[model samples]
Target chain A: MAGFFAFLGDVGRALWGAWTFDTSMAQWFGSHPDALAISATVAVLAGASTLLGNSVVLFLNRVKGWRFALSLLLNGLGFVLLYLTQAVIVIAVGQLATGRTVAWETVVEAVMLATAPLVFGFFELVPYLGPGIAKLLQAWGVAALLVIVQVVYSTSWWQAVWITGIAWGVMQLVSWALAKPLAALGAWFWRLISGKPVLLRPQDVLSGHQFMPVEFDFQLEPGEAGR
Target chain B: MIVSLLALLVVVVLLFLAVGPLEALGWWRAEGADEAVTTLAEIRAAHESVPEPVPYSHYVVYLSGIGAIDGTSIPEEEQPLIEHLRGHLPGFAVLNDVFPYAPDNRGLTAARPMARMWSWIEKARFANPEALVAMLVNARNAIQLFVCADRRYGPTYNIGTAQAILHSLFRAGYQLGSDVPVTLVGWSGGGQIALGASWYLGRAGIPLTVVSLGGMLSDDYGIDELQHLWHFRGSNDGLEKLGGVLFAGRWPGAVGSPWSRGLKEGRISVYELGPMQHNVTRHYFDTKTFAPDGRSYLEVSAEAIEAVLLGTEPKVIPVEK
Candidate 1:
């Protein structure tokens, strides 16, 4: 009973962290209800795609490289578009830091296994610490990645940590370099489809607008402004 | 020893060809349900819909029995009855050909074989549909059925059958409870599936009607979820009674078969056929006793369903052996 309660407490604290984990992620997710709905749909499709992709790899043993590529492409569907873009960059950076020419499968498998602990990301649904728990899980995930790296590469602990840390740094820098243009592109497309200028001055919207109107001429519903 | 084993493999292959795939594989568990696809299957329209010749509005999604249901061509044995029923009810009917132990689209068989070749061969059409091969070559009449190619009959996976049916119905444009109402019709073990699907649909508060024709009923909470249940059982159907006797469901009290209580409560209608026997619909002549009578349980049950769909007074069959 005590052990059970301890486990519960651990989960509770972890969830508390997740609730407060990443406010920016939450803000980004919450800012657009339409995007959130689309993400949920993508999550379901991603799950289906992963199952199909993995099943194909496991069952159909012939032409492995093509099958592996197909599996990766299928998994990318679940990447939540830009939602997981940062996560990939982070993992890629960790991989580079390891400085080992490990098989892609080994790294992919290790990363996949390490992320199992983040199943606690379920806590991300909790109001208070959802984001914190998620963010903490990312750190936990990194530590796990380091252990995997050390084992797979047969390296010293310090080397593993250094590899992971530098790799993450590299990834973060690269993602930072790329995120702006992608976000701008996504935002521009969003405005085009929604017919609403977002994050753009009216004159700039007009000047650059090959597609969308350069006007924010509508009033927000009183109850809808906060959302 | 190698030559003997090679000969044995040949014999096994020949046996599979003779008895059909289900018995050959003894395998019921399969992956890849094609969860989203509802194949439309074959449909029996009462008359011409383009000229508005008939006032056909309702849909009955047909779930086949055990190993009998397959992904290949729709069984033609069912055509005579559906044709007869469509004329009266103008009720459009489609076969839900989701097989649990049938062959897959890839032509790959299950890795395991649950039934012995001799045992399966002797009964012919007793359990699974015997006309599987003959039915395979039967021409499709442009109607669609949501096919779940890898569905096997055990309870562990039957829910997938139900879920697939639910999605198929939704895709077919039948609103949950209203507008175009839905009725689930299952034969033999398929009855359990209809009831199980009813449970899921009921929990969602969707109005449903489940019609089980000699379906193997289990004690489940879904029975209470259905708006109405029409059970057609022959007195000679030993398997239908097997659920109650083996599982201890049909007891004197309401512990086993909810039929007694549900019958009294007026939510369930039981049609007890005396001369009729199990497997009499598709395999009518396969059994010695019911085959001589030359009556198709498919026709009888279809009429009973027609009554339910038409909202007319139901004709009652007395319980007799």
Candidate 2:
């Protein structure tokens, strides 16, 4: 239990570092022997938080039993892959723009730490304001990532912004290119787990039972007729 | 120490906020399905002796505020107002046995894990004179109100609530697609619940009108489906004002929102009652407090509602900024 609390403390500090744009924490993580392990934990925490945050969709779709468990696992895997892709793009763009040979481990660490604000991702479950909260968290993560890039790559604010912007554009193109194949793969996996094709639209997921007004058959009991 | 305390407070608040969505989704899935269905069936069964298609031209469903524990638990102070409305409106059937907090109309003490706690709180509410216990009751129901207004959870919650209302109306001999206008009189948090359920109710073909009495409502799309909305607020009611402050769609700058459209198209009307508080000590239903015109506050409110229902326009007093 003590060890678990310690682990939580470490994660919290890493997140706080990202929030405050503290350069020393980034530098320490970049060179620490256990940097990879620490980064992996942060990524896993992020993925878990994101999965919990998005569980509403699965609940809304009424995914049940093994399908529900499998959907969560699949979502977690998707989050990891998305983080890896973003990290790799940032590294590529940072090196090209700054002419600096930054370590991939350092870039990955920065990226994972940047997503620490998403620890509050479950807040997306909040009514009326949930979507707005999600957007605010995303913007916070992006800003953290920008600051991390500047510190890690030893670049000016303009250079970091340019690199981040370019990386984002490249990430979008890659996503667009891989969208079809990724979707097919996801569908195939969903079929294997749930024995059905994936529901692609919100309405399709919501197409189950709806509450309709029932006409009451008001027949009286024998003793209650005169009352 | 204060920082830690503040952090803890935030976590508590976040946890509290999370419960509303979770409870709503639970209801949508399987939490109260059997109970809701059984309750509806029982309501119909109870009304078995009433003549089929009982002759009432219009129906008024009164949704009570956050302080309610069950359909029958209309606060003693507010009972006279319900009685007044019924007495004044000749051809209208007024029903108040619908609890706005739960989609299934289940009371807080109704067969749940936390039923004992809520039951205790309710007992304490009457036993103790302190307002704290009552606030707890309000807090719990207020979360449900937020769930009803929430985009992600609102549809499911509203659908369930609409089902409850529809069944209640059915038991009242409301014919489906009968074009008999159903007026929803929602007090406080019940106002938002009324608006949220209006969409599904409208789709079911009941001509709908909503009267929000000091209701803290949202800028819901249900405004588009309403025949008209008459929102009443007391001059001293800051809680009701919070609706306009909190909902971006209610702002004048949000021209594209349904509420803005409703305002522009004249489907919604806002009226001010003089110096009425939201609810509690000196609220809308407080009969002991007399206005300058030698009438009780309850009478004034009931008269305004009566005017709206009778299609006789009441004096329009602009709300003070």
Candidate 3:
């Protein structure tokens, strides 16, 4: 339990360090032999936070039992994969923009560390104000990424901004291009795990068809009309 | 000390926020409609004893405000209002046994993990004159109300609430698919519960009308599904106005929202009750406070509700500025 708290403290410090563009954060990540493992842990925390925050999907779909557990695990894995994809995109963009080589591990570490803001993603569970909070967290994550990039890559703020912007744009384009296939893959995986076809649309969830048909005895006996 | 207090307040707020979603999600785990059967059975037995037959002309399900702790308990101040409503509205069976806070119609003091703690809170609330402990009850129920209005949790929570309501209606001898109108009279948070349940109730072919008494309602529910909504707000009820301000969907600018559409289509009506406060003394249900016409506030509110139920224009009582 103490180790867990210490790790939590480390995560918090790393996030704060990245946000302030502290050189020590970049040095800490570079010197650590378990940098990749630590980055993966951060990515997983972000993934889990997101799943818990927007768990309406699980509830709406009525996913339950071992299937629910599987969905959470798979979704978390999906988030980690997405983060890894972002890290790779950032590294590619950084290398091209700077014309200087940086360690791939360092770039991945920075990307994952930047996502530390999203650990508060559970705030998305809040009603009405949740979406606004989620948006603010996303903006914070982007800002953190810019700062982390500046610190890690030894780039000027403007260069970091350009790299982050290009990377984000590339990620968006890649996501848009692969959106259909990715969604299909997700649905297929969901079916394999849950043994049910996923209800993809919010309308489908709200359609009231998922509920059991309640049988009401509307038939009134004679002389029961106006009692 | 001030910083510590501020930190504690923040923690409390966050905890309050977390509790709603957690409770709503818990329903998914306990798939069975786990109602407080004892309470439902008692209510059902009471309804059975009524001399009236299978269907009354109308069924008014009264959802109490945040002060409600259980299905069986009605706040003392509001009891007279219910009695007044029953006395005036002939052919209407007023069912107030359904607890609006829990989606399963389970009361806080019902047999559950938190029952003991809730019971202690209830005791402390009454034992203490300050009644600060009562705020816990209000805050807890208020969170459930938000869950009912929330887009993510609303559908799940509302479905369960609708099911529980359907059970209560059946027990009350309400004929499903009957042309008889079912009016949900929700006070404060109860208003949102009524609106939430209307979606499923309407789908079941029940003609639904919602009567909100200083209700903190959101525009998330199926307003189009409601036959009509009569929202009564006391002039001094700033808390009631918070619904309109807090929910962006309630804003006039949200032209696509159900509430805006309901307003445009004349399915929703807002009425101003004369200078009544939202709660406690001099509230809508306060029997001691009388208008210039010599009718108590409870009488005036009940009469207003009766008018809406009867499809007549409610006479506005004159009040002192």
Model 1, range B1-321, lDDT digits (tens) per residue? 897699668545433332242221222213322221221111101011112222226667776654342432234455554556656754464545444232232111224243343233324444555545323221110001101111111221333445566556655554432434567877665576677556445443345788877766654445666778887777778878775663333455654344555666688877674446665343322322322345345555566667777787655344443
From the highest lDDT down, the ranking of the candidates is 2, 3, 1
Model 3 residue B104 distance off true place after TM-score fit, in angstroms: 1.0
Models ranked on DockQ: 3, 2, 1
Q: What CA root-mean-square deviation does each model show from the true structure?
A: 19.5, 6.2, 5.4
RMSD of 2: 6.2
Candidate 1 DockQ score? 0.01
Q: What lDDT does the true structure give each of the candidates?
A: 0.46, 0.77, 0.76
lDDT score, residue B108, model 3?
Answer: 93
Worst 10 residues of 2 chain B by lDDT: B42-51
Worst 10 residues of 3 chain B by lDDT: B32-41
lDDT of 2 by residue, B75-116 (tens): 566678799989989999999988888877788889988889
In model 1, which regions exceed 4 Å deviation? A1-227, B1-56, B69-76, B91-97, B100-159, B177-179, B254-264, B280-298, B316-321
Per-residue accuracy of model 2 over A1-227 as CA lDDT, tens digit each? 99778766777777678767787886666666666666677778767876777777676555778777888887888788887899999988888898999878788887887787787788877776677777888888888889888988889999999988887678779878987888788778777876766543333322322222222222234443223
TM-score of each: 0.39, 0.87, 0.86
